[model samples]
Target: MSKKKEALLAQYAGHITEKFSETPNMAFLDKVVTGLGPAIYNRDAALVSGSDESELETVKANFLIKKLGLEDGPHLMHAIKEVIREYGASERNKYRAVVYYILARRFNKEGIYK
Candidate 1:
């Protein structure tokens, strides 16, 4: 990984450990970050807005359904809401990598990254 990417990954891992209180699987997390490509470099794109309905919908439609190949249903939205809750409603900067990591783990879709 590039120095910048590596630094960002470390920063993300720190946030995950600090906020979520869980040590992330480095390999899987790396894959998630890599999969995100250039978006990670963009400040706005790197963060998930838990308060935005459309943002959450995009995560469900694009990431969960399309990327993970999950079926559309109420459960998907429920899962997204659940994740958002776990991520903390008061949390302003919800990193997309962390959110995607949690969602991927929730759906057992980590294998897709491999």
Candidate 2:
């Protein structure tokens, strides 16, 4: 993984630990991050390291929709691209942070992360 992704993951781990302060489920958080982290890392790495941009976006869109359980549409596509640009344009490492944030928020709302 890239240094940037490593840093973001560390930061998120701290936040997760703090968020679960009463119970302090670092084990669960660790499991979640470790289990899901590599895929996010590799996808972003491919986006940055690979040559085909359009193909990557298509693949990324598919992955995001499937992983996020979101509907496939132009709006979701625009939102994905917008989030990427909003967080940090061309910064693959930061992209995972946003993706994780989205996923975490969804899980939290579903009472899975809490």
lDDT of 1 by residue, 1-114 (tens): 799999999988987787778898999999999999999999999999988999999999999998999999999989988877887877888899989998898899999997
Using lDDT, give the best candidate's number: 1
TM-score of 1: 0.93
Clashing pairs in 1: none
lDDT of each: 0.91, 0.47
Model 2, residue pairs in steric clash = none
Model 1's alpha-carbon lDDT is: 0.91
